[model samples]
Target: MPISHQKALPSPIRVVLLNKPFQVLCQFNDEQGRQTLADFIHEPDIYAAGRLDRDSEGLLLLTNHGPLQHRLAEPSQKMPKTYWAQVEGDITEQALQQLQHGVQLKDGLTRPAKSQKIAPPKLWERNPPVRFRQNIPTSWLSLTITEGRNRQVRRMTAAVGFPTLRLIRVQIGPWKLTSLQPGESRDISGDPQIATLLKSPKRKSYRSPRSPQR
Candidate 1:
């Protein structure tokens, strides 16, 4: 029998949604002996879509599909990425408004962000926790922004005089970080979120997506 000429339907994209833990590099391999995505994920070939800093934790997506990765990783995509930031000192209404209106940074002015004080989200504890400052109280805030700048959340808080003590990404596009414990990851297939990643948010900006940390 002759081999059929019809091409098989493309296999569903392999998408890995990882709740990355603090202190782990976003990349799969690191030469500095630091922990990396490889420590938690042994899957081969797939690369991280966007970066989560070594000090930051939560929702980090990985995949081998280049176009899918580009859609999520591209700065032009304007996909809103949300974060929960535990900032030093109680956040003031003025500060929250400043954040919502956007603050001036060395990189210029950030696009307006969706920000509101939020109750501390129930989350896993970091191995080495943030310092306990008895004199200064901390508060949590949820922030959503369409631009991915370098240490943007931390910078935004600090710009408003609220230094971020801990940061965790809670969502990207339509995908939330719900229920996934630190360092846990799962395969996501055929979800509407995959389509949502490519859509742009309401605003526009020239800031590039966060580059992989060295």
Candidate 2:
């Protein structure tokens, strides 16, 4: 009789969605002793798929799978990310149009973005609240972009005459921040659909069907 051999099943992928708080470094370690993802997340094997600036806040994804991480973080993938920005003035329609078309930056002209004026979101108050100017009124915007250039959102708003005062990412690709408060995280490793998607040989690019309204 011939001996039978069987291949072992692959380990389940681990993915974590975290609502990163303002002022926390995106990395796990900080030489300056500043707060980092390590302060909140204890998973040793997982790493941030992409990064948010230390001053920016909201949804950040981490994963243990290298391919999944690359798919999410690579700028060439053109994954859309939605952000809620509180700008320094009553943003104008012209500004929104400019943003929707394209904005010139030092690097190059940015790709066209989906831009709209929106009401201020009901959100957790920041510890060091945004500076308030009694004379100047501020407005909010919901902007979605597919690029990952450094400070792209802030620069885009500033180029159109409204500097971003407070920026919060609300969604990335198909993942929504939802109700997760600052510093809170959820593990989505058991999602069978995500597992299957990761394993698919002919996977399509992930894109949001429509721009996020808020």
Candidate 3:
């Protein structure tokens, strides 16, 4: 028998969940001297799976695995992402219904979303905190959707007549932000089931049965 060599498989992917802070860009580098992921994450090779706008805050996932990144970031995958939004008014049921049913924006009508009014979440104070309007009351909302259009969440709420004062992503697919504080991160590569979840067939929706109470 002739001797033969077999190629070894690459190491398992590394996934880092970050609690992105307000005003930090989702990218690693910037030319305008703005704050970016580089300021927080010192790890090499890992890239953000998806983006959280500079003005937005909270959970962000980074991975060194290209296929895994594509799986999570691709809009067609319909990986649900949940957010906690503080809006400009005492949100009404009609507005929540509009959000749940679908709201029309300049881009187009959004797909039906999971939307509900929630009590204000206990969170670290934001620098240059959301402007306080004594006469205008603000309300919190939990919104989940399966798309990644630019500023989609903000636009959706505005279309429903409530402008978002603050936005924080709380979950993505099977991952949760948990108790991570701003600029903190936790590596989840050791979780045995994560590979199974990532390699599973694409799902129409991947939201949790019960939303996390932050």
Candidate 4:
């Protein structure tokens, strides 16, 4: 019998997760020489699926597949992103309800979201720790929303009278920031479970689109 030759399969698309640190820019390059993604990640040809503000810290997904990146980043896809936020006030039930029901912002009324009180998440200290106010107490809340409007989370908290002191993204779609310290990165390649979740159709938003009044 003749020897059989088999071609090697190409590597599946790579998905990199980084526990983005506070004050770090989300891009690979910055003209001002500020800390950027290149300071922590050195992967070739991979780009962030979405961006994290310098003031926010936590899970940031990067990938090589353009379509997959768009699916994750596009707001229209409506993937829920979860965050643990430490707000200045001891959040009241009414405020939590307000956050859940959506508050009116300068831009417009936001879609209803999931919000609840939670114990502060265990994590590494921020390089410049959040200010501690001796007289005012702070509380933690877990907020999940399907939109990614610029500074939306901060604005939402402020609108409800509980200004966020610290915000950390804990989950996005099928990925998480658990156990990954600040500035650390992990490769979640070849995980079929996550791939399925990523490729799954977007979850329909609970709220119906407002109909125009005649």
Top lDDT model = 3
Tens-digit lDDT track of model 3 for 39-108: 9999999999989999999999999998889888877788899999999999999999999998877656
Best by TM-score: 3
Q: lDDT of all predictions, in order shown?
A: 0.86, 0.89, 0.90, 0.86
- Residue 73, candidate 4: Cα error in Å is 0.6
User: In candidate 2, what are the lDDT values of residues 1-214, reduced to their tens digit?
Assistant: 9977978887668999999999999999989999999999998889998889999999999998899888788766777999999999999999999999988887678889999999889999997999978999999999999878788899999999999999999999888899999999999887675665567564355423332221
TM-score between model 1 and native? 0.87
What's the distance in Å from true for residue 82, model 2? Answer: 0.2
Per-candidate RMSD, Å: 3.8, 5.8, 6.0, 5.4
TM-score of each: 0.87, 0.87, 0.89, 0.87
Candidate 4 lDDT over 145-213, as tens digits, reads: 987778889999999999999999999986788789998999987767557866688755333244122
Q: Which ten residues in a row have the lowest lDDT in candidate 1?
A: 205-214
Which 10 successive residues of model 4 have the least lDDT summed?
Answer: 205-214
Cα lDDT, model 4, residue 184 = 91
Sequence-dependent TM-score of model 3: 0.89
Candidate 4 residue 155 Cα shift, in angstroms, is: 0.5
Ranking by lDDT: 3, 2, 4, 1
Model 3, position 202, has a per-residue lDDT of 80
